[model samples]
Target: MNRKLWTLLIPVVILGLAALVYRQAPRFPQEGSAAVIFARDMRLHHAQAAELSLHLLERPVSKEVRLLAGDILVTQEAQIGQMGGWLDIWGLPFSGRQAPMAGMNRLSMGMATDAQVNSLDTLSPRQAEIQYLRLMIQHHRGGVLMAGQGLKSGVPQVEVLAQAIVNSQTAEISLMAGMLRQRGAAVAVGLPGGSMNGMPMKP
Candidate 1:
């Protein structure tokens, strides 16, 4: 084929393949299925994680905290994009008609309240590191919880993503714990209802 003809055919071929894949993809989750709930709520939860990490990055903090903040920002932003893609592919709205985490037993997913979020701005550099570590520990644990729920979804892709969350966030939590101790702050206690094993009890 001529170069001009090849260029015209390339785009058409790509779109045709994409449409074929979409049609052959597994059946989409129903409105209240674990897949939909996890996608919607986890995206919101990850947005907060990325936002809080950005706040930490803007301040003068320890080298460890800065590195951790940058990692969180990048990682959670990617996760948010992945979950958003899932929602789009499934033909679901990004926000659900029911409340956030509605199918997940109304768990707040350990989100920081407005007061807690606002407090980051007023803290000293070292204090900010401590606070961010504490809040992120809670946030990550919440991710483990949500991801645990995803394991019951029976969707191979969703289960794989959830298991990855369980693995990665559990390790991050341990690292954050060590960092907190280095900063002379105790590790956060009373993590929401779960041991550090990343398995959440079903509500």
Candidate 2:
């Protein structure tokens, strides 16, 4: 009833209303948001990795290579589904208007070119295994980089998935490198150098 009390009460009422509105606000990634871009691009990236794994599986390869391919196929497919689900939840189209991996080099993304993909079909079993290993290693490197960018998006879901990709793929990269050495081959060169956690990519 007093003037001073009324002024303090008015401020408290305004603060309460603001807090209520904030709590009800919808939270989601916008079209141009980093999370959206990461989801869209990473889905395509995972699709390619899965397809490459399938190609390798169709051939007669070593047991180790066969098992690795199967793992990659399953993991990438699951991740693709996860990212696609996020896009749907955000009410975004599966694909975006911008070119895939926009603002980043395709090689940086470790994507196999049309020619490279076609080349797999022409290789003998042994040759296919070697080619697939090299390509997938490079591809994982690219995924690491993209996922690193995703981590910077400040979206909780994006950061969690991005970190998961970084951890799993980085470990897989090491495994595949060993596989390459066993075959007397080396990882393909000339790709960018960076880890998913903003560090230099490990050899």
Candidate 3:
């Protein structure tokens, strides 16, 4: 009778321990998951925006441009921190080994090329302001596009940040457009459903 009882208890204990282990197992976002991709790509994207803003700040920009640059720098840096935190929590590396934005037009993502980024240093203060506005406007548009894609991530945090990005960057695009007009400059890159120098913006 005692042997029979011990056998039943052994199976029950093993099952309980198995359930506990499963419950405590870490559930991380898989490689190439939407949340992981968004977190990684957005960090890189925000870094460029912050860098541009910082560079603009070093020049003798107008009062309005200075304030705008300051705002962008602060906002983007904070978002970068948040995204980095997400990646850490997901048990992922800061950057994936895969090529960034593989198979996508880096421009469509609103990324500046090495040449464009290098050009920022060559401009006079006035030129810097205008160029900054144009580049940043295009950059914001790209951010909006990427954020729109991220909205489908189905991860609560990613979706929330993506929505916030869409709202803020869309408003900033309009604001920058107005600034461009004030400077008597036109946007070098087109907005959504539009063309920049005859090149249509990707949907």
Top-lDDT structure, candidate number: 2
lDDT of 3 by residue, 47-156 (tens): 99998988888888799999999999999999999988988888889878885567667776778877777677889888889889888888887787778557888888
All candidates in order of lDDT, best leading: 2, 3, 1
* lDDT scores of the candidates, listed in order: 0.81, 0.85, 0.82
lDDT of 2 by residue, 1-203 (tens): 99999998998999999999999987889888889989989998999999898878888889999999999999989999998999899899987888657776777678888887767778998888889988988898888888866899989989999999999998998998888888898775545543445555653
Residue 106's C-alpha lDDT in candidate 3? 74
Q: Global lDDT for candidate 3?
A: 0.82
Q: Which candidate achieves the best TM-score against the true structure? A: 3
Ranking by TM-score: 3, 2, 1
Off by over 4 Å in 1: 1-25, 103-108, 192-203
Clashes of 2: 0
Angstrom error at residue 118, model 3: 2.4
